[model samples]
Every structure is written in C-alpha cells, then in structure tokens.
Target: MSADPAAPRLSASGAHFSVWAPEASHVWLCLFDADDRETRMPMTRGEGGVWHSEATGVGAGARYGYRADGPYDPAAGLWFDPDKLLLDPYATAIDRAFIYDSALAAPRGEGGDTAPMIPKGVVEAPLAPLSGALPCFRPGGLIYELHVRGFTMLHPDVPEAQRGTIAALAHPAVIAHLQRLHVSAIELMPINAWIDERHLGPLGLTNYWGYNPVNWFALDPRLAPGGIAELRETVAALHAAGIGVMLDMVYNHDGESDAEGPTLSLRGLNARDYFRHAANGQLINDTGTGNAIACNQPMVRRLILDSLRYFVTQARVDGFRFDLAPALGRMADGFDRRSPLLEEMRADPILADRVMIAEPWDIGPGGYQLGHFGDNWLEWNDRYRDDMRRFWRGDSGMLGAMATRLAGSSDIFSGAMTRTVNFLAAHDGFTLADVTSYEQRHNHANGEENRDGHGENLSWNNGVEGPSDDPAVQAARRRDHIALLATLFCSRGTIMLTAGDEFGRTQQGNNNAYAQDNAIGWVDWAGRDTALEAEAFALAALRAGNADLRGAAILRDADVAWLDESGAPLSVAQWEDPQRRRFALHYRGSGLAICVNGDGEACKFLLEGQAVNVAARSVRVIPPAR
Candidate 1:
C-alpha cells in the first residue's frame, strides 16, 4: 500500500474508502459523479485484510460504492459478488435512498449467485466537521426517550417532508415543545443505517425503532432529509437549544441476524472474525437475533471503540446509551466488571466526558449483569421499574423494594454509583398509557400472535381492559400515570420518560412495535388530550423546580425526607411493614413535598415537621414551601 497524501484515509480523507475482504484477490472502488460519469479506482489491500483508496476531487455530494472479486462459498459464510454495489461501512452520508428491488433481497436456492442482497461498500463524501458542540447533560440529567419520526409524524405544526426525519426534530416548534417538557437530554432510538428485517419488510412493516444496525457510522438515510449531514444539523440544533443528544447504539449485534439472514456489511466481509462462533464453528445465538458480535476479540474491540470515537469526534454526539451492553462486557470467562472495552471507553480521551449508559444485559449466559457495571457508567434500573410498578399496581410485599428503588437502589449501585436511569416505561415495553389500559398483551397487530413481547409487564388495567370510554376508568388511569411520573421524578437518580408518555401516547397495546414504523409507533401530536398534557407539563415543571430532588447525593438533605402516612417522620415499624403503601417524600431544600398513596384507597399523608394543608388522590406534589 502506498502512503500517498492524495490516497484515501479511512479516518481522515473526505472521499476515502476502506473494506474488509481478506478472501478477495482484488477490489475496485467505483465513483459515480453528479454528471453521471463513472470513475473506477482500484483499492490497495493493506495488512489485516483492510482495502483502501482515496481521491482528491471525490467529496461531498458524490455517489460511490465498491465491488469485490473473491471466491464464492455459502456454508463457510463468504458470499462475495463483484457485480453488486456495496455501501461503505464508514460512509458518513448516503447519496440515495435504498431501493428494495427483488434482486436486492437475499438470494434463495443452492447459491448460484448469492451476493446482490448483501451490504454494499462505498467511498463516502465528507461534509463539515462537527466541533464546538459541548456535552450539555450528564449522568443525573433527565432523558426523554423519543423516536425521531414518531415524535412528530402526526404533528400538525411540522411540515410534511420533515415529519419523520431529522429535519422535523430541528423545527423550532418541536424544540420549544421539548424545552417546555423540561428534560435535559433526548435519548433518541437508533438512527443508524439499517435494513428492515426481511420478514418485516415482506409484511409491509419496517424496522421503526432502528435497533438493527447495519452501518454503525452512517445515519439512516430514511431518517435524515438530506442524509447524514441533516443528522449533524439536527444534533447541532439540539445542542444549541441546551439539550444533549444521546444515541441508542446497538454494538452488541449487527443487522445481519443469523445463518438465514442477509450478508449485509460485516458478515459478508469476514463473518468468522466479526461474529462469535461456537467451537464447532456454528454462529453463536446470544443476541436472540441469531448472531452475537465478537466483542472479546482485540480487533473487534478496536472496531467498536473506533466506531464510538468516530461518532464522538466526528458526529459530535453528547452521549451514547449502549443497547444490550452486557454483550460488550462478556469475556471468554463470563461477564466481567473490568472488560477491556468498558475500561478503554472509560479512559478514552474523546469518550471520558460523555455520558455512558448501558442497557446492562443480554440473552447470553450470565447476561443479566444489571448492577455489575463500573462506577462511571449509568445503568437502566429494571429493578426500579419492576418494584415501582408492583407497588403502584397494588401488589403486596413491595414496600421495601419500592423504598430501596426510590433511594436509587443503593443495593445495586453502592455509594457514589447510585446514579441510575430510572423510568416506568421505555420504548421496548408498553407505553405508560397502555400499561394502565391493558392488563394483557395485545400484540396481535404485530402479526406474531400475542407472543412477541415480554409476558410479565407488571401492568394494571385499572378495573377494565383495553380502551375504555368509561370516564371513571379514564380518570383512574390518569391518576396512575401521575403517580408513576411523580415516583420517577422524586426518585434518587436520573429519569427517562418515553416521548408520548407525557401526552398519553398508546401503542394500542403493542409493546414491541419495532416493525410498525407508521401510525402505530408515531406520536399523535394532534390527538393529545390537553388536560393530560398539562398534567405532564406540570410534573416536568415540578421536577425542574426541585433540583435537590434529582441531585446526585444519596444522603443529601436538600431533596428528600421520609415521612409516614400522617406526614410525620417514618417510624421503624412503618418502614418494615409489608402492608404499607403510602409515604410522604419532601424535598426540603427545594421546598416541594410529594405524597404518594400506592394503596387502593386514598391515604392521608402528613408532612414531616409541617402541618398538612392540602391533599389529593394517589399522589400530589405540594407547591414550594414559603
């Protein structure tokens, strides 16, 4: 390989390109100019199977792809086709939308020519560098998990073209709405370039949530108005509004699922090296999606780290919420607290100041390592969600667990590590509205019977199931929603609210609506119940006004005070009582008091060391103290 300055640099060149096709004898870099001109550039095969090429004139707005000439074999997991135009794994921008031609689908039968359906490589055109963006939010920051499309697809104010893309999110009206909601950061569901799972695409549904990642470095062209550049603009806009952008990254697995899955990018290039294989040479199925990424390997670790660095340094993202993060921490032995990947990320110069959050578990052996992550990392507290749900739904023997969760689950995260990402619901499960309206899962709309989502939702239907026109049931549901929000806001950790939860968004009881990219998943901005929206807005305001409540200190007197049902100090007996369902938590420093009644009937809660002047059903946050 020549060290020419004009040659493409994978990390630096504006029109640089690289591919991993060790088995290929030769690879060609093809560029299609704006005037429909074709330029064929040969790639130099470097050490470690990486092919590279660069050109001076090839830059932003250029359309290009790659072609590899290699031996063809299906059983061995090498399906190389020189005729197909592959996308670059590192391409920062996509010049065109992915056209779903039948020829592009995975080839069937005895593998006559099975490469067109696979991921294509390309030489990316570079745009302006992303710098000057600061990390505006931290671990204790409030995060609102939202779908870029879903948040504004039905928004009356958003333009038609911008409705479901990054452009919509950057709209001033959208920014103002989020600002009014009072969250510090927006944890967007995955926006990485992904292909709809073949089955979902066949069913006329798309991968709406964007969890299946194909190219870690490229933004999904479908989500961006002008491709990747639009994504950068959206991030910049969010940062300008004092809101941090945290991407939900799926590094645990690639879009390529299993043996039957399509050979998108990484798998076709080097399946054996990229994916974990059993001793018998079969693909490991730890991700529950057919294959697991080889995170323990040094080169694989470097790839993952390099991808993260690219996003941080180039994309200027504020933080990353790692999806199925336990897979990253898995080692040859088992889940390790000091995993090389985790340690490297913690110490990395570019990643050190960013917020590092983890889903904290996978489906593999010892996969449920929730509280086992390192100190600098914030974990999704599933235990908090479960316990809080049980308490609110009138379950017994949950008082202790609820109390522990309210105190930031100190048992899971001890000392200074008590900061958790607490939430009643996220994108994966039923929305807060659905949780209170459906006792049983109604995922038939997902076309997978009712067996697609989690069986144990820990939800209550409030005396009726599904949607109910009964005003009483509706009022109860609203109250339950308010209670859950209050609990989340007053809890001793960072809080995350689903996008539509604030305005009562329902998936119509479809908990796992990953494939429903249309109306099912999109937030109905026009159909919002104004009263409920106001309540949500008020809850956010209350949370913001009481800074001590969301502060990092576990023993801090500024935010929290324990009180009995009568608003007096909690007694030892009351703390130990399994039947107790009501407590008063007062943020003395912030001068806000919240009374919670988890019991079926209302309970009179007293303010500790203060006279009880006001009361409401289930839960209520008192105004700031005079």
Candidate 2:
C-alpha cells in the first residue's frame, strides 16, 4: 500500500491497518460504527516507525481513523494529539467532506475528541488496474483548464443532482462542448479532498479553487460523491470521446496551516518529517500557505509517488500539472532541477511517460525556476501571457517580444523542442474577458481589502473600464478577443485555454475569485458569446489543419520569414522599430501564413504578389494563392 505498507488493505481474514508515526508514545486505530461510536484498537510498533493492527471483521465501507499520542511540542513540530482524528494519507475514499471548525485547531489538551468533526477514511478494496490504456493527449495540443464544480454548476442541461460533481463532466452536453473546441484534454483543478482555510469561515467564504488539499488520494465528497469510481467512469467516458484528463495536483502543501492549524492527517502523524521547517523550529512558508511539504524526505516522497501511481493505474488519467511545482523539486539547498523527488518521478516506470507540467514558481527563496525544469517537463510560461498581453495593448517595442512568444519562447527554453505551455489566462489570474475590461483587480469581495490578486495584470480597459454599454468599446473588446485567440492558436508548442475564456466569461473584474464559490466563480453558460465561441472553434480547426502551427520545434530560417508590409524581408531597423505593429509570417511551401495587425486601424500587407487587407487589432490566417 505504501513504502512502509501502512494504508489499510483488505485481507481474507478482514482488514489490516498500519501507519508511520516515528516518535509517537502510543498509537490507536479508531474504528467507527454506523451510529458514529468509536472502538479503539491498540497497535504494535514495528520496524521503521510503523504501527500495525488487524481487525478480524472489518471490511470495505467501514469508517476508520487513527489517533497517535505523543509529545505535543509545537516548537519541535511534534503535533500528536489523540483527540484529533487523523486521516490516512493513502485513503482512496472518505465518508464525508471536511468542514472546518475552531475546535479542530484548538490546543492539544484544550480540544475534545474530534472524531465527530473529522472525516474518517472509508476502507475501499482497490479497483483492478486499468490496462492497455495510453494517454490521449500530446504536447502542443489544447488543454482546457476548468474547475469541476464551477464548470458544471451553471450548465442548464446537466441534471440538478449531477451539477457541481465530477460525474456531470460525462454528460453528453459537456462532452459535446469539449469536442466542439477540439479539446485535447480537460485539466481539472484540484479534485482531491480539501478543507476551507481558517480565516474563510468568519467571512462567510470558502476556498473555491481546492488548492488547500487535506488528503492526496481521497476524492472530495463535495465533488465526487461516488469517490474514485466516479472519477474512473468519467475518465473512461472522456477517453471514449478521444479526450484526455489531466489533474492539477497540489503536493506543495496540505490544508494544515501553521502551528495553529488542525492536526488532520500528516501533521498528527509526523509533521517533523512531512513538512519543511526552519532551524528556529518555525514552518517554512514556501507555498505561501503557511507551510511547505518536506518533499525531500524519503517517506514523504514515497507517499507522493504512490499517489501518482494510484491515479494512473486506477483512474487512468493522462498526466499532472503540479501546483507550486518548485516545492516538489525543492531541498535544503533550494530549488534544484535534479532534486531527488523530481528524478524519481521522471524515472519511475509508471510516471515516466506521463505529461508533467509545472507552475514553476513559489514564494520561497530562489523559487522561480521557469526554464530550469530540464527536459520531459512543460512549464506554464508567464512570459508568453505577459508579453502577448503587452503586445496587444500596443506597448512600444513589444513586436520582438511577441514574435518570440509566438515562436514558443526559444530564448527561455534552449532545447531542440520547446516545453512552453503558452497561455493567455489561467485559473489564477483574470479571465480573458476581464483582461480587456478591467485595468485593475477588483478583489474587495475576496475579503482581502482589494489587495489580494496581482496588481499589474498587463491588461488594458480598451477605452472603458468594467462593463461598457458603448457600442464602439464593446466592438473593440470583441476584436481584441479574436486577435488574442488567433495569436494563441498560431503559437508554437502546447497551448492552454481556460474553460470559459473562449466564450467571453468574466469575473466582473474580480480577478481573484478563489473565495467566491457562488455565481462569481461558476461559468456563466447562458451569457457566453456564441460568435466568439465560433471564432475559437474556427481557430482550433485552423490549428489542427496546419502542421506548422501545431509543431513544437522552433521555426527554421528556411521555413519561416519575418516580412514587411511590402512582402520583403524585414530589416534590423524595421524589426527594432518600437512603433512597428503590422507584420506577416510566411511559411515556405506550407501554403499557410499569418498576418498580425496590432494598430487600431486596418492595413494591407503585400503577401505572395497580393495585397491582403487585415483588420485592426486582429490576426488573419492568409491562405496560399490559387
């Protein structure tokens, strides 16, 4: 079940329970009945800090938890409390979703038994490993990132009972929509079991993004009522439709915050080895979530690797995008490309071929390790997002930068093939529509006094801030949207588009809507722009039809040419001109070319003996001459 073989495994006799609590004075396996009563079974200490116990009649669907009693010294990071019921790190299912309470975080002796408040790990017999299934997604394909709850919550066709659940994704309407966009994969934001932040309860808010995960293997009951089975079925459905599934995993930190946080699972078992700490005995705040996972530790690495293997073999997911990925590659020496955990994942037979993308940054020291992830990894390129935004905003001297990004940011990635995942907007920042309508983040609703999100969004208001009734302003915004989408599809390497961005979804200027689990966070299906959606579909088709646009390799000198309006090769002066906006890229022998007009007025570009009229603030895919 694990490196130390600690997770509950079913046996012919009954069920076997084990856990690793190195310094605990005593540990008890807490078994609960249908009426919520608990039975304590003492465990025997074994080699390597493992505690083992056998239940003669325990079987699948039985709810259980662990209680480790030991030194409760906060300074030393030994947070063991028998009163706090701890979850199993390898649990595949849970009886209920976690709801935070002040008592859960109360001091070791001050708190009462949390058995009723905490969720118990439900014993589940493992499903047979999915065989003969390979990932359906390839790099340089469209990755549609969406929150499972937010994406399906407002869908009119989805049944009321299925809304906001993983099963809803398998509904015909959702699958049809993904097929329309030619989505290569659906990158689901964290679906693992998570808990609300401590401060969120007071403000009547919750962590809508599911970044604060509590257990790695358990599916949050709020999203997946059927647990791992639901996920497996949905994945099978997506695979049947030729779509892949990618999970946004949060291994950097757990929902357990600082010293004052609850002793849910890892903290109660072994916080000293599970989480990173400074020499002064304080938790390291690398993830900005009050604690950073000690991924460098042997046992912690084993647990993470086991979780990945479980998802791949059981759920048949395509790959993973690591949130705050620097933590996984971090050690006492800081972020390293050759970190042990990273190496193991790349070399592991189960995970070696899976797509591994990185957020590539954290708030830790030397945390931004963008292009340093080495080969076999794709990174979320903020440079592509920022540069593309700046260029379309008509910022001077942005032509060169935009060209570089469109060509897959070869400067940042020095490999033969680029590993950049070019994207305009993702789950963290402003939606595509908000990027053109809001000049600043309106996050007052986040309860952070409007100071929570990114300050400089590289965004422009297009002559009007927020929603505008002015016809000209609205028209300009639409044009900008089309132009931005065309640039993305025409770019090299893998590309990601947020779920609602194609149809003009907005957060009402609230860039940081992580706390808004209501209407603000849900995708507005009724209000989507049909024309813009059609435009995105056409762009996807165009990208799919052309090899040059989908190719990951950088364009060679012989294959592509940067030309002026007159169709001649561009000179250094023209390339360096800060005011230059109009340019054409001609791919020799491909019968396909692209013309970009960044100015506010339309212009004509001479291409292959014909003058092509290009609209202002737009990009045109010029066809070959007949």
Candidate 3:
C-alpha cells in the first residue's frame, strides 16, 4: 500500500486508525462486534484536520466505520451526521456490498442509526507490493471492456461457486478465450464498491453496471469475495498468460448522488471539502450523477493518486480507463488540460508507464474535451464510431469521414502519434450486431419506456427491426459486422472491443442496459455466433501480423496514397463526390492496400495493375506483392 503512513496500520497490540476530516467538530471510530453492536471510541484531533485513534483491542478482520460530528446544512453542502456511519476512504476491503435503502437518504437527524444498513470497512493488513515486469499491454493493442459478472455469469466451464467473480477470470477457459481474441488487455468495468440509485429499488431493478461507485479503494464484495487478494491473484494469472488488466475506474462522482441522495462515505464525512459546489452552495452536477468530486482539491487529488498507486502496487495491473475523465481535470473555472490532478497523474512515476485512457467527456460545460488531454492519455474516439457506423449504414458523403477514421482520425487527434481508441461499439451503446439489426432502442425492460438510450444511434435495421428468420437479413448483418470489425482492425491506432461484441452480443436493442442485471446483460456464451467469433479472431490476427496496421503514427500523404477504384490518385472531384463510396488506401511503405466498398454493389479496384474485388458493405485487406 503506497498510501500515506497515517492510513490505518496494524501493530503488535491492535491497530492505529486515522481519518482526514478537518472541518468536523469531533470524530469517533466505531467498531462493530460479532452481533453488530457498535462501540464508539473517541479519536484525538491531530494536525492538518486529520484525527487519530489507537484501538488497543481491535485487530485485523474487525468491522469498523467512522462517525463525524459537525454541521448538517444540506443547502450549504455541509452534510455531517453521526447517525450515518461512514466507510474509510482508505478501506481496502469491505465486509459487504452496498445496497440502497430509503433510510440512507433521509436528512441528517431523521436517518437514525444507519449502521445497520451501511457496510463496514474490515480492518486488513496490506499485501506485499508486487514487483515484476512492466505492463504487457501497449499502445495500438486491443482493449476488451467487460463487466466482471456479465462476462462470466453464463460460462459453463466456470464453476458455479466462482462464477461472476474476479477469481473466475483466472479460469483456464476464460484465459483461453482471451488468448483467442489476442486481447492485449481486458478492461474490467468498475469493480469498486457501489450503491444502487434510489429510484431503482422502486422499479424492481438495480444498477447492473458498477459505475455508481462509493469507495475507490475497496473492491466490491460481490465481485471479489476474497477481497483485494482475489484481484491480485487474478491479475497475476492473466499476466502469466501474456494478458494485461485495466480497470475502468470512476472518479467523477460517488454513488452518494445529490442532497437527496445517500449519505455514504464522502458526503457524510466532509461533503463541503470533498465535493464541488456552486456559489449558491449547491452541489455541482457536472457528472449527471449529481455531485462531482472536487478533483482540484489537494485532499481529493491525494486520495485519487493513492487509490491508483494502491491498485498498481498491490495488483500489478496494466493500467486504467477513467470513466467520464473530464471531471478529473475540471477546475472552478472549467476543464483544464493542465489541471493539478491531471498533471500529477501524468508525472507520477508509478503511473507514467501504465496505459491511461480517458472517456474524454461529461455532461458538464466544456466537458467534451476529445483531443485536449495532451500527450499522455488515449481517448475514446466517438467520431470514429459515428463516422464508421454512418459509412457502413450507407449514409451519403461519409467516404471521407470513414477514410479519416480508418486512418487513425487525424482530424480529431492532431498529434504525430494518434491517441485514439477507435471502436465500432462500446458498452454504453448498441452492440455491433444490434447496429445492423435494430434501428430503435427497445428499453422498456429498463422502465424508461425506450427513452433512456441515445435517440439517433446512426444505426440501420437491414430490412428488419431486430432478429429475423430471413437468411438474407442474417447474411447482411454478418457482412456488416465483418465490415465494422475490419474497419476497426484496419485502423491506425488502438482499438477496443466490448465483451461479446466480437461474437454478436445483442441486448435485444436495449442500448442502455445499465439496469439489466438479468439475462439481457449477461453474454450468451452458448448462443454466440461462432462464425462471427472466428472472423474477429482472424481480424485480430491480421492486425497483429501487420506492423503498418498496429502502428500509432498518423498517416501522411507520403506514407499512404489515396486512390479511387481505377487505382489513380484520388482527384479533388472524386474526394468531394458524395455519391462515391469505393476507395483504396495503399500504404506506400508497407505495400499493403485496404479497399473499402460502402456501396450496395460489389466493386473491384485496380491496384498496380492487379485487380482486387471487394464485396458490398465490406472491407478487404489486400496483402503486399510477393
């Protein structure tokens, strides 16, 4: 644990407890007995607003929480209530997962004795730091984003006991699947402890996606029953097989939500200092989840850095993909590329070598900072996704856009080394199969009446709204999937494939399946399209075998020759022709040619006197001459 030495540490007699609550009038370390009885021990106020306490009898495995006594002004963002037990921000292990209760949201004095409902931080001894080789993943590698539970819940080989847990990932069947995909890293989506939204309990639904995080350091008990050790062991197992792991972390907001939300860890401890607030003293809603963490604040930055270091030192994971990353760089004025938190992360020795990717947008003002994260970060490129879909959907005037996206999206990323993580589909939207099979979102199961997901998905139904018995429709969808995957694999920079997207996973057109913890969200391993899976494997192999395709360098005019179907250099008129859809990009140095035909008719392209035929709505990668 690279966290501050003041963090809870076990000694010969018992344990030393410490907390940072500068504004609180007093703080108490509450330890829970076997029967859930609480004993509050007074903590002595220390320098710099931190409180310290020595528990002579308490040792490892002791369930404990903190109670801070201070102001209780909601409007002024000073939420403090001794009734609401708070989890330690430095807690590495939690006794149980968080479940939403209406009482958790009740006002300070009204929500009496939340200890019964709240999860306690289990006192733990820090694991020895891992020392090994650098991360196995690198730029321009395939990143597979998957929810831990959804990915393995249906796996027949994974044990029933181990299913849907971090330990399950170490199973040989799972590692074999990853190896088949040639995955450089598997990005686990938000394994941190989280609470369900208050509305979900009433709707008979719960948060399936773990995006609503409550504690940054503690692993979700449901995901890792063995706690941090399970993660460390799983990571070691994956690394031994040449696969890296990346956590999709959420630092934008806690599950504590708004004033009406639950008084979890940060909100109950020091809401005024931990969360960003407006001039009117209202919590800032930059994250769309209610309150955004004050990343610019020194304590918040330290916490975030400490969390990152703890994961690295303990688990030895490859890297991280920050969810809604703009929140990390947002200051009082606006989002700054050189914000203290962002700069510190980039400069941190432990984190500098690790792969860092950014979601790159939020709902806040100036939140869509795509290419502004400077040189150290790779960003998820929405433009690539949109343009690729539009082009394959047969939208007019998308030839240039499609070519740009396939060429590493130079227009968006204006650097020598493109920082784009191009993908045809992601977890939050329609799957690749759904993109070709559904024109509208069907999310009534989510209780949102199909109005929750993105309205204009730039998708096509291919003569059917969803699944169809028509072989022609099925063939068309398969062709489109190949085209989409080929475009992504043939692109210049890093690529990401959401779990099951490689094998035609569909949410029945439910784009926003965040609340679907049932069969709708789990990857149907048995029902997956084997042919599509084979195509994905072949495409991955193709990308890996070709140096030109996997390189991160932005293509220049000298490096690539843009040609029309006739093999002649593309003219101004041809580039401007909206109706034209066939083109070939021949990499001059590698002698490789990528021929794309977005038209509904198969087209043949002449490359250096050799004719290469490409199917309609498909892309063909032609190898160089012998």
Candidate 4:
C-alpha cells in the first residue's frame, strides 16, 4: 500500500484503528493513491480480533482498504473472502461507488469467480489547503427533518447528477430554499453506509429512505458526488449558511437481520457478541428487525461511543437523533435508567454539548417510554402526535389531552426533562397531504400486499377516502392542514417539520415508503403551486421568526388565558365538560391571542376584553392592536 507521508496514522496522537474480524486468520493493509494503485503494508493482529498498524505518514487524505484471509461459511454468518477486498469499519472516506457484479458473488477460485465478496475501505482525503474553518452550530436549535435526495430531487433548478447527492443540497438554489424556511438545523435521515433490503431488490425497488445502516463511520457513497471530500465540502457549505446537520442514527440494530439474514459486516465478524441474544442464543427482536444491538455490554457500548465521537470530531456532525433509543437502555431485567451507555454519553464532554433526540421506544415489551428519558435528552413526542391528530379530527374526549400537549405535556415530561421534539408527521408515517387525503394506508405498492406499515394512522379522509375532485373536500383538507400547522407552531416546545410538509407533499398514501425510490417518495418540488406553497412557507417562516414559540418557559406573568364562549375566564364546568371543544387560548407572549375553534361549525364566540382579528373557518392568531 502507498501511504501518504503527510497523513496521520491511527496510533498517532492517541488515535487507534479497530475492526471486528474474528474469522480472519490474517489481514493486510492495502493503500491506494489518487491513481488507484496499491500500496501494500502488513497489519498486526491484536487481542479480540483487532488489527493495528502505526505509521506517521498515514493521516487524512490517504486512500486505503483491507485484505483478509478467513473461511467463507455463509450458513454460520461468516462470509469472509479476503480476495474480494473489504472496507475498514473505521474508514473516514470512500473512493468510489459499489459496482455490483455477479462475479463477486461466486465462490472463490472458480473459472468465473475473480475474487471473494469483500467490503471496500476508503482512506481520508487530504484537507483543502485554503478551506476556511467551519462553525459548529450548537444544540437548543430547531431541526428541519429532510431527505437529502428527496429534498431537491424534483426541484426544477437542481442539476440531474446533483439531484440526490450532497452537492445538490448545497446548491445555491436549495440553500436559498432552506434559508427562506428559517430552520436552525437540518436532521438528515440515515446517511451512513447502508444496503438496500433484499426484498426491495427483488421488487426492483430501493431503500431510498436509508434507515438500514451498514457502516456507522462511512458516509453512504450514493449520497456523495465525489466521495468523502465531497461530503466534507457539503458540510462546509451548510456550516457557512449557519445551518447545523444532525444525523438520524440507527444504533439500536445493524442492517443485518435475524439468523436467516445475510452476513454483511459486523454480524459476520462477531454475531455472538455484537448482537443481543436470549439465553438459548436466539436473537432478540426488540428493534422489530431480526436482532437488537447489545448496548448493555461494554464492547458494544464502546463501539457506539466510538462511532459517535468519530462523527462529531472527524465528520463534523453537530448532533444525532437516536432511532429506537429505548433499545440502548435495555439490560437483563428491562430498560435500565442508569444504563452505562446513557451515562457515558451524557458525561462525555464532546457529546454533552450536542443535541441528543431520541425516538424513545422499541418493539420490545414496555418500550414506549416517551417522557421517561433522563435529563439533557429530548424525545420524539408520540403522545403529542396522537393527541393533536385526535383533537383536529374532532374526536370526543380529546380537548383535555390537547391542552396538555399544547403546553408541552407536563404530565409525561415531569421533573428535569423539559424539552420535547413535537411533530405532527415524520418520515415513517403518512405525509401531511396523506393525513387528510387517505383514511386507510395504501401500502400495496410496497410489494408486501398492503400489509406493511402501521394500520392505526389516526387519519381522517374528510367525508371521502383518497383523492377527490370535490372543491369542498379539498378546501376542508386545506383548512385542516392550516389548523394543524397553527397548532404545531403555537405549541410550547421545539417543533420539527418534515420537509415538504409545508407544501403538502404526498406519498400516494404509502406511509412506509422505505423501499420506494421512485417519484412517490421523492419530494415533488416542481408540482408545488407557487401561490399555495408560498403561503405555507410564509407560515413556517412566521413561526420561526416568533421567539416565544420556539420553546417552553415558566409563564412568569400568566401568559396564557383560557376563555369560555361567553367572553369569561374558563369556569370549572367549562373546563370539565367533555362536550366543550371550542375555546380561546390568549397568549401574552409576543402580544398575540390565538383563538382555536375546534367545533365542526363556526360559532360566534365573544372575546374576553379586547377586539380580536377573527377569520371564518380558520385558526386565527390576532396580534395586539398597536
């Protein structure tokens, strides 16, 4: 291997390279220059299947991969083929796209089989000589959830090659759109190295949503134009725009499924230790996938912590949203409050400053622990989503629940836990457009006979299911969308808006389009009606501009005043009555009074003391009369 003299070695400056390769009898370091020529070097095997090489010349900007010699036993999850060229789990950069070749799948040393199936590794590229330092945006920031590919895939202004890559997102036009949206941060869906599910491949579909993570350190080559350097440039561009990037990480499980699944990377190396198993050695299914990561174990926790540190310090990632976060806390009895993984993450100086949002549930028993997370961690408020949906859909006995959600759900997030990441919709569920367009999930296109995805959508089709040409139905859907947006913005917590939700993007009722890479899942930027889209965009901008709406406070001066129908402070009867759905919430912050009319028909309700700006068939925020 050819090593760059200027590149920093893993052992230099307290850095260490590690890979789990239990089956490998011997492994070699193979470095390459920009010309793709090999620079061969030997690596020493350490305890517990770790291989290390110390050299001063090998630093960032060096191109390298690994070669292993091990048994190829697919049945036992050992797919080790050193001749196929494997990637380093600690690799910071990838050189090229993974060109699928059937020949690579064949058995080694055959007439047609060139080599064994080996994972490719990439070396870090040299830093730009004139690249300026980028600022790291901190936590307590508003994160705009978006798909890198979907965000600009259909935008009229974006170039074709740059459509789904980081370069496209950093394009001036795309950045302008984000700047106009006024989001403080962007929480990107899983961008780590991933593989399309086997089922998706069989159906000619792709895992466009990228939730299946294969390598925690390497960025997915599909999302980068010129490999790792390109990603760095993209991060630099986003940082220059003052927008931080938070990755939605899937650490609770690996891309490898259960015992029947393919032997990809980690599982193939060490399944018995990496994966959580029952006493009988059966894989745990807490992640709803085939297996759950053993986070309670020391080595597994170390791997997770190492991955996080690499992203934050090396990749310059600002924060992370842990997928199936409760899995990270599971132990022998159940979910442990004092899990060492959680403690280390909280106490770590590098991670402590970053935003740690959790999808605080798994598929395991007693997994839906929404508000039970410890201090300094924010949770995805599923309760808020359900309550908000019910109240807007005109469900009975929902008014009280709505109040608690609107005020940041003090009942759930009691004590030191304060912040809640509230959202009406996310990537896994129906889009805002689908919410009002379909009562039943239409996932038949997913090639799973419409049985996939959640059945309990809590959606209302507004008198007719699916798409309708009726202007009245369309108008009502629009009104409901606006109402939900208003409620989301007015609620007392950090709000997260799925990209394109502001413009009413739809997935044709496919709530779980994780496998669909077509136009159905891609954001239809060109189809947006400028007039309507502009109005919605303005509403989002307005929400972001209003400082009082960003997060919760102590309500120092009783900023919120609840009023009954007759212009009086809410009485005991009015507050207790389950039938009462219409009420006014006057907010003193920013000198605004928001009147919510939840009833089906518009009622002429009196204002408490002052004349307020009221609009028919709408949730109106009346600013103080100046």
Which prediction has more favorable lDDT, 1 or 4? Answer: 1
Query: Comparing 1 and 3 by TM-score, which wins?
Result: 3
List TM-scores for all candidates, in order.
Answer: 0.91, 0.99, 0.98, 0.87
Q: Cα deviation of 426 in candidate 4 (Å)?
A: 0.5
**Models sorted by lDDT, best on top:** 2, 3, 1, 4
The 10-residue segment of model 1 with minimum total lDDT is: 2-11
Candidate 3, 158-251: lDDT as tens digits: 9999999999999999999999888999999999999999889889999999999999999999999999899999999999999999999999
RMSD of each: 3.3, 1.1, 1.5, 4.4
Query: Ten-residue segment with the worst summed lDDT in candidate 2?
Result: 1-10
* Predictions in order: lDDT: 0.75, 0.91, 0.91, 0.72
Supply the global lDDT for candidate 1.
0.75
Model 2, CA-based lDDT: 0.91
Candidate 3 residue pairs in backbone clash: none
lDDT of 2 by residue, 215-294 (tens): 88999999999888999999999999999999999999999998888889999999999999999999998988889999
Candidate 1 Cα RMSD after full superposition onto the native fold (Å): 3.3
